[model samples]
Target: MQQYNPDFDYKSAAEEVLAIEIAGLKQLSQHFDTHFVQACQTILNTTGKVVVMGMGKSGHIGKKIAATLASTGTSSFFVHPGEAAHGDLGMIDSNDVVLAISNSGESGEILGLFPVLKRQQVTIISMTGNPSSNMGKLADLHLCIKVPKEACPIELAPTASTTATLVMGDALAMALMRARGFSAEDFALSHPGGALGRKLLLKISDIMHSGTQLPKVTADAPLTEALLEMSEKGLGMTAIVDADNAVIGIFTDGDLRRLLSKRVDIHDTTIGEVMGPNPQVAHSNMLAVDGLNQMQERSISALLIVDDGQLVGALNMHDMLRAGVM
Candidate 1:
């Protein structure tokens, strides 16, 4: 093994490579001719799913492209060309679009499956470095992903080609996403475990405390009773509601401290006498992330979720935080 250098500056070398790859991707803006639009329109018109196929490093990029397309509203899956020969070709359909990725557009593994794929009547979208190669010529649509040079010092590795391929994949997915009018809610449906899902899919009713768990007091109730409700519910505040259970005011920990500091008698004062009226509230159907934004905007810690002006539930900042909506 070669001797390790204590001052190799690996981080700087990596940054230089990334910078070169980024510059290479910037150059691809010139390659987006009418053919790019045609490719997008063809994929969009296909009633069947998109099938991605590639080999080696190209295969890795193809898999990610498939996943991104799926998440962004285009249904797609990656099928290794090698695996297609071993019976996975059944995944393809006559109406589907096939995207074949190969740096040289002459990958034997991919070319090996072209005849059969063509028989299935699938439209072949080829992405390659050499547009004149056999795979590129045979494709119904060809996307050039050429690079000036590899970022590697020896010009042998695949840094620039891979970056160009990845950028092209992103462009395609984003194009399809916009063409389909895919919304954040649609994206959340596919990424239900991600932050966007928490923002778009989780509702106020799903996480708010309801029934006996809700820290609430009648408008006529004594301040001592309100304090007890807040303590029992473990929320930092209590909601003061009218006879119809409509939230009319709020009393928080800060209010309690102020009342105590002024030597106000909790036993003598009613919740209506000290509560802050016309407090901010939300509907149970509102997104939890929206509720969080509202709370942050109002500089308050809790929110009361009401339906038809009736308090259905309540939640505090800690609850939203615990739910990962904060």
Candidate 2:
């Protein structure tokens, strides 16, 4: 590697690169015409997945495009052009749409598979810098990803062209996402292990302490007993319930702090006398993210899950944090 140059004007060089890439993107935006709409409609109308194929740097971009399409409600996956020629072409179905990426629009490996693709009568959408190139000519649909220039000094490496291609891919993915009316819940279903998935898919019942794990005490219980239950359950709070186990009040660590300042007789005072009334509650089916929002808006750290006014479960900020729902 070249040694770091102290006087290289690195910041200016980086800014120039960004400016060129931005210009390429602007050029790309002008090409989003009927062809873009047709591409979206083709993918939406298909009963099979979008099989993306490319080579070299274009291949790398293809993988990302495929991933974005898959996560945004369009089922798609990337297939290496070289590999496809070697028997992976069997992955293609007649109902599938082939998205072929080649900056020059003349990748031999990609073009070599076209005859077979056409024989199978699969729809082909080609993304390229040259619409007149053979691969583009053979495609049923052509999307121009031509950029003004490459950021490379010699103009050999794919730079602005790849950026334009990736943005074009994003435009297609988002347009299809909106066209399908894909909701966050649907996106979360495909990304169940991600943070957004946890926020959208996890319910209050999924992480809340329930049954014997819940901290609760009878309304007539002494304040000291409520504290003992809170300590035992390790929830930092305890619910005060009536004879039917219906939640009437709640006492938390904050309440204990205030009670301590007032020199209240914990042994003699009943929990019902000092506990907070009209405690904010949620149903078991409430989303964990919504529960987090409730706690945040009310300036509280915990929430009680109740069903028909009966105390059922409890959760706090710690639980939300642990569940990755915070």
Top candidate (lDDT): 2
Please state the error at residue 111 of candidate 2 in Å: 1.5
Q: Per-residue CA lDDT of candidate 1, range 25-129, in tens?
A: 988987787778999999999999999998899999999999999999998999999889999998898999999999989999999988998898889999999
Off by over 4 Å in 1: 3-12, 194-196
lDDT per residue (tens digit) for residues 138-241 in model 2:
99999999988999878999999999999999999999999999998898898888788899899999999998999999888888899999999998999988
User: Looking at candidate 1, what is the lDDT of residue 143?
Assistant: 92
The per-model lDDT (C-alpha) reads 0.92, 0.93
Which pairs of residues collide in model 1?
A: none
C-alpha-based local distance difference test score of model 1: 0.92
RMSD of 1: 1.8
Each model's Cα RMSD: 1.8, 2.0
Best-fitting candidate, measured by TM-score? 1
